[model samples]
Structure formats: structure tokens, C-alpha cells
Target: MMSFISRTVAACLCLVLLGCVAGQPERLAIDPRYDSVAPALQVYMERVRTGGERNAVLNWEEAGLAALELGDTDTARSAFDEALLRIESVFSDTEAAAKARSVWYAESIKDFKGEPYERAMAFFYRGLVDMWDGDYENARAMFKSGLQQDAFAEEQQNRSDFALHMFMIGWCCQMLGDYTAADEAYGQLREFRPDFATPSRDDNALVILETGGAPQKYAAGLEMSELRFRRGATQGVSRVDVRGLPAYPMEDIYWQASTRGGREVDRIVRGKAEFKVVQESVGKVMTQAGTAVMASGMRKDARKETKYVGAALTLIGISQMVMAANVDARVDARFWRNLPNRIHVVTTHVPCAATLPVVFRDGSGSVVQGGATTVRLLPAGNGFLGRATFLSSLLYGQ
Candidate 1:
């Protein structure tokens, strides 16, 4: 009996040591050439290189967007491809994932796949990279895949509600000269998003506008295990106008980010938290009771049976206390930061060669200071594509 108790205590101590030493992440050095890139983008690139596979998805997301803004299609394509590949892969069966499930490990120790919306946005950017290359068929497929990702939301009602992908799917179909498929895609958009004006077959220019800042992520609950998002404020840029073109509000990213019902991590984290509390509470009770029994046994009148029971109970209590100390219940707050808050689209008929003026207005219809630009439509065979990105943090001094 004494041998068994000694073995159990030794095993618990070993586990505690193994849990503390295992899964220490490796850090890599960043190349100096990336130093010349934009500061925000440089940081993401460094994280992508430094954090390695564990945080590949999160860092690549920021890096991809930043690369796109700099017109570095090669880097953007690489970033999105790396992120999407990991996002689509099955990580649950891997060793790291298995370890992460243990109470001794943090969920963040597993390779991050990101929230559904973040995964969807990776597809969105990958699709845009295809569009930039004039590969309409692949671009259409990418948009459809993005919609599929959005369909995986925990709440069924919120699933498949990303209107931007549907609209872009229609545009890609139209570009490919598949009028029937184009109409079908547009029809679906019309069903859910009636506010968006349907594009005419004759229209040859598509303007995509990305505005505002990324949603902020934070952990909630007693153990900081519940994932939550704080929607980014628009900061005075509410409405956008393109001369001689019709513009529409396509999608709000914050809506997609927050609407996903719940994560499986939520339950696991909550369970770990509760388990820790129970272990600690029960351990204290057992220890106190055992101490009392042992004290009584020390008295002249106590029997040998009481002394044995006290020793066993005290050992069990100590083991439980040790287990409780090793429990890790903190949430993974890593996110795809720097994503735009909202996405908007503008369309116009062909022969629109002139550089068209774009205006940004606040909620009260007042023009935002310095919030205007002239965008020249780039020729896309029979049509054209234009892009405009706004970072309100940089624009409005946020």
C-alpha cells in the first residue's frame, strides 16, 4: 500500500515537470530585406517567419493584406496559400493538437486555424490574387470556397450570409462569359441582399472598396477562455461615392467575425476551469479532514485503522492539489489582425476611361477631409477592375 502511494506521487511530479518543459515554441530570425516594407506589414512578416507553423495562419493573414496593398502579388499569393492550406488541413489528429487537449497544455499551443470568418477572408484575398492575374475561373472558385467557409458558422442562421462573396462570384462568372452562372449567383445575392444593385451585363468596370480597420479580439469569462470581439468603429467614413457609377454596401467583416455562435474551445476551456476549481476545493476539504483524523490518531485512545486512513487521505489530497496547479485554462487570443472592417463594391458601364473621382462621407453626409481619390480603372480584357483601401486608424487619427 505504501509503495502504491509513493508511485502515484512520483508519477504526478513527473507529469508536472513534463507539462512545464514540453511544447516550448522555436523562434526564427527575420531577414533584413523585409525591413524596407511598410512598418505594419513588416511586423506581420516577421511574425510569420518567427512564429513558424504555430501562428502561420494568423500572421499570414496580416501579411497577405499588407502585401496586396503594396502590389506585391507574389508575397500575397504565398501568404494566402500558406494560410489557406493550414486552415483546410486536418490538425486534430496531429500530436500537437492532441497535447493541446490535455488540461496541462494551453489550447493556443496547437496550430492555429483561426475563426471561420478569418478563414473565409483568406479565401477572399486568395480569390483577389486570382483576379489580379486575370484567372476568372479560379477566382470564381475561390469566392465559392470562401462562401463555403462562411457556411461553417456555429449559428445556422448566420451561416452562408456573407454577401460579398456572392456578389464577387457573380462578377467572376460574368467575366468568364458564363451568363447563366452569373445570373444564378446574382439571383442568390438578390435574395439576401436586396440593397445591392444588380450589375448590368454591359457594365465593364468593377471597383472594390475595403474600408475601416480590423475587429479587435479579446478573451472573456473567469478563466479568460471565452473568445469575444470588439467591432471596429467606422471613424467618420460611412458612405462612399464613385462618380458615374453605382456603389453598394457589400459586407461588414465585424458582423461575420462576431456572429459565429460558439467555438468548441469554449466548452473545453470552461471544463478545464471548472475542473481546476473542483480539484482545489475538494483537495482542501480532504486535507483538512485527514489532518483532523491524524491528530485524533496521535491521541492515546486512537486506533491503528484511523492512522492508516488519515495517511491515505492526506496523500490523495496532495496529489489533487498538484494536479490543480498544473491546469491551464487560458484562451487563445491570437487573431488575424489588420483586416478591413467592411467591404464595398462599385460598378459602371464600359468606355469609362477617365480617372473617376471617389468621395467618402460621414454619417451626416459631410465630406471627410482628405478622404477622396481619383481611381483609374485597369483594363481586364473587355472590362476593368479597380481597388481602393481605407485604414481609418491611419485616416482619422485613431
Candidate 2:
């Protein structure tokens, strides 16, 4: 029996070595064209960690490339993270592969709008896994975000992997009691592949299949991976400079509760309510209208921006009337997590051109505990620039 167990263990090890590890999905393989390139890359990687200067940039590309082949996302994310970290250094370094390295690097990251291509694939697969596991809501968000990141990926082959991905979203949404959203996703899918027509009205099978399970419908993830791999090879990735700004570096932030709100949080959003100064000093009586909202921003480059989101609209007693000022006097702005705080937009209907009292807030309605507030001039749309954290928080929140 012991000898038999030994033989079984050896057999398992052999299979793993042959890339057939039990319970692990068969991963995409490196192309034959890369056969020569792979070994040379392996050698180069070792040199960097020992005596040679760390080619962090090239290593990023190489590591990402390898991790992607093995379908290892966390590793890929770390590799890209390192590459982005070395951007400034990369600019100063000299390497024969820099041009090619830059291409993969740029294709790997994006701002709040989305993520890079390979990461998008990771998200796509994660969504696929979620779908397989019957977690539709989580799957929907993942697949949606994956498309946002992997838009036009050379790997996606312009074949509307997007359409197929959304089909999964619709499937999951249908399972999650969100049939309306599922139908909408199905509708948008037609826009991607005009050739895809809904089953004939008399064909009841399609409806039955979507509404009822045929034991967790088939997933096209492998096909997706293959199509994407083909696209990546064919796509020409030109390096896109980090446009606008990157997300705030939360890792660098050292948070120790301080009484001073000036405590440089990771980000801030300052919005203006369209309320004009009803009564200012003796000389300034002006009209203003405020918009209520919540917004988020990144602290990298210490950024700020505005959006014209109409106040939180509602139907009250079947009549339309603006909601009263947040009695708590707070809104959440600055930080991509929430609707922006109400920016106190006190347009100087005041001919005096005098500054209006602008208040800012943190998330809570309380005035930003304590701090020195500096505000830029409020541009068109937003009236007064509220420098206080408390007032800014209230604008978007309550």
C-alpha cells in the first residue's frame, strides 16, 4: 500500500510538471515565437537581483508577462505596480528593451476610469469565476469593469468579447432579481454585435434558458483568453503617458487620528450648493442656487475637479421641490467613493464682487474638526469656494 501511495504521489508530481496540476485550470501557454526569448529573460531577471542594477522597469514587463501566462493576477498586479513605481527611474535609465517595455507598462494602468489591459483580463476571469460560482452581482461589476479596462485590447481582437462578457452580466443579473438591468445589458449587447438577434418570439427555449438554469450555463473564459492572447500579439501598444493624474497613493499615507483635519487625507472633493448669499454683510445681499452632491478625488498631485451633478432629485408628494439644506449641514466630497459634497456655489449676484462665506466639511456634518483651509477661486458653475472641510463634506452628504 505504501509503495502504491508513493507511485501515486510521483504520478501527480509528473502531471504537475507537465502543466496538468489537479484543480488548477489549464493556463494559456507562451507563443512559440517566445521560446527563445523566455530563457534569456529568466537569466536577465536573476542578474538584476544579484550584482547588476535592478532593472525594475524591464523586470516589471517581464514579470507581468510571465504572471499573465500562468494566469496569476496578484503577481501580475504586483509586477505592474513595480513598473509604475519605477516610471521616473525608467525615464532616466538606459535599456535596449525600454521602448517595448514602455508599451506594456502603459497598457497596464489607468485612472479611476479603468485599469490596464492585462489586468482587465484578470478582472474578466475573476468575473467568469464568480459567474461559475453563481455570484452574479459580484460577477456583473467585475465584467463591467473588465470591459472598461480592456477596451479595444489588441488581445480582444475587436470581436466584441464585450458582447459575450455582457451576456454573462445579463445572465448573472437575471439570476439576481435584477431582470430590468439584465434586459438593459441585453439591449446594449445588440449594439456591440449587430448580427446577434434575439431568439424569435415563438422560440421559448432562449427565455427558458436565461430565466432558468441549465446547471450553471457554459462560460467562454477560455475562448476569451485565447482571443485576447491573439489580440495582444497583433495589437501595437504605443506608450500613453500618464494623462491627467494617477490615483492618490494611499499606501504612503500614514494615518494617526489627529485633532487637526488639515491632516492631509488621501483626497478631497469640494462642491458648491447653488445657494446665493441670501444675506451677507450690509453691502452684500445676493442670490445663489446650490447643487447637492458627493464626489471623490485622488491626492496624488493634490488634485481637485468639479462635476455638474444636479442635486439629489426626489419626488415629494408628487410635486418637485428642492430638498431642504442638509439640516446636518454636511456633504462628502473629495475621494472617489461618494457623491461629491454640495459645493457652496454662492454666485455673486452681489455686484460687490465680494467673497461669500464658504464652508467645507469632511464626511460627517460636523465642521471639519480643525484646520487651515486654502481654496482656489471657484470657477464658473460653482459659486463660492468653501475652504472648510466641514462645509465641503456637507455639500455632498446630507
Per-candidate clashes come to 0, 59
TM-score of 1: 0.84
Model 1 misplacement above 4 A: 1-24, 27-40, 244-246, 291-315, 350-354, 392-398
lDDT of 2 by residue, 1-398 (tens): 99999999999989877773344322323334333334424442342233122333433444443443333445445544454444323243344233212321211111111113333434544553344344567768876865564353334344234454565566556556667887787687767545544322221111100000001111122111111111111011111111111111111000101111321111110111122111121112111121222132233442344212211211221122222221111121112111111111111122221323322233343333332233222221111111112222112111
> Compared with the true structure, what per-residue lDDT tens digits does model 1 show for residues 183-226?
99999999889866778888878888777877878878866667
* Worst 10 contiguous positions by lDDT, candidate 1: 389-398
Alpha-carbon TM-score of each model against the true structure = 0.84, 0.25
Note each model's CA RMSD in angstroms: 4.8, 32.9
In angstroms, give how far residue 337 of model 1 lies from its true place. Answer: 0.5
